[model samples]
Target: MSHASEVPASTPTIVVTGAGSGIGRAATRLLLAQGWNVVLAGRTEASLLETAQEHSRALVVTADVSDPEAVQQVFLAAQSHFGSVDVLFNNAGIFGPSVAIDELTPQQWDEVCRINLTGAINAARAAFAHFKVHGGGRIINNGSISAQTPRVNSVAYTVTKHGIAGLTKCLELDGRPYRIRATQLDIGNTASDLLNDFGATQGALQPNGERMVEPTFPLQQAAEAIAYIAGVPLSASVNQLTITAGGMPHIGRG
Candidate 1:
């Protein structure tokens, strides 16, 4: 019988940004469990360590993706540890706040742009460069429901995710010759174990200025979706995927 996970002769190593927590951490775990090597990267060493602890196939790198230098170092460390990089999950992001666009500060906007958009750019560039040499690789950008429709007080996040959608298309076009394929996973609310303990979830503002608790799916489901995308042989590709809670207000706006 053919194995479900037929790891290629060349060891598959994936670099996951924002790997210290939330979706990144969940995806990293699923990837690792599926016989692929993983490089856990984020701003916090302690969290990365916890994610990679006792995992022989895991490499932990403390990287703040917004810093170009730091981002470069992450790929370098991954290449050094695993010999080559096969996939990069462009998944690091933050939700700044829910406020009126006029009330949003310049610093807040810049901060979100730097980490959400610029960070993905740096990582995508690095991965493309590496894939160019290695003949190809995959990059899965973590987009959001906001990418498709704007939510109140989410200017920075919405803008950056729309930027990600653009970036994914660009990569898909430019990387075709080299076998570098790109995909975007536009996810909705995902329940995080870490956040659940703290009761961190709150009402999300609707387009009509209504605040309501957003529906959420298990974080693992998103991780598995990512793994499925990453696992497909290079011959095939999933260009874009949107996985949101069944009742999330994404398909139609209020």
Candidate 2:
């Protein structure tokens, strides 16, 4: 609950994509409370402003991460306002249609890839450019449990998440000389608007083809994990971290 003391003497600035709601919103609030300046980026200006909550340190930047130019603008705006950016939270993503592979449309797959995979790549590239000049920076990618295991009828979402894992590894390897650290948080069943829409609150589809309600943890926990990783010094790095609801059927066979 308390991370203010862990923060460096100088205020750190972080750019969080998908800051409009869910984990991004939660992490932004916590980061602000911990004395970090955050630039909120997403497709909706209104939601990003809402997430800002009139915080003096929060800058709202409306951007669709799928656009490389827009993603570059998010970092540029952050630098213009905050002077510098210390971390990039690549969290903007969409869970495409949930249907069998044969039933899935090509457009649906492309949409998910554009946002989930390509979007993260764009942000990472921009951040890497900034970090090289600024000395060092961190990137915390919001990967999903689907990165490691796939659920029934979740081809698009799962594939993009797996792609994110690969992206994370590439960043880590490629950014070492420049002090750019990358970490992927593969979270599971965190309560969010997306989860509710996916029917987790009622019952989610199981791999066994059955529907069952799954336990979900609060958004604060996931946010806290992100904050912890963000606060770590560049001298050390957390390559990957997995946080999940204890009752979620991810650790073992359901």
TM-score on alpha carbons, each prediction:
0.91, 0.95
Give the alpha carbon lDDT tens digit for every residue of 170-241 in model 1. 999999999999998988767874223212257656668676676788999999999999987778778999
Candidate 2 residue-wise lDDT, 1-254, digit = tens: 00111223267899999999999999999999998988888988878888888887888888888899988888877777678899999999888887889988988888989999889999999999999999999999999998998877788899999999999999999999999999999999898987865677798888787898999999999999999999999999899999999878885426
Q: Could you list the CA RMSD of all candidates, in the order they appear?
A: 5.0, 4.2
Off by over 4 Å in 2: 1-9
C-alpha lDDT of all candidate models, in order = 0.83, 0.88
Candidate 1 Cα misplacement greater than 4 A, ranges: 1-9, 193-200
Pairs that clash in candidate 1: none
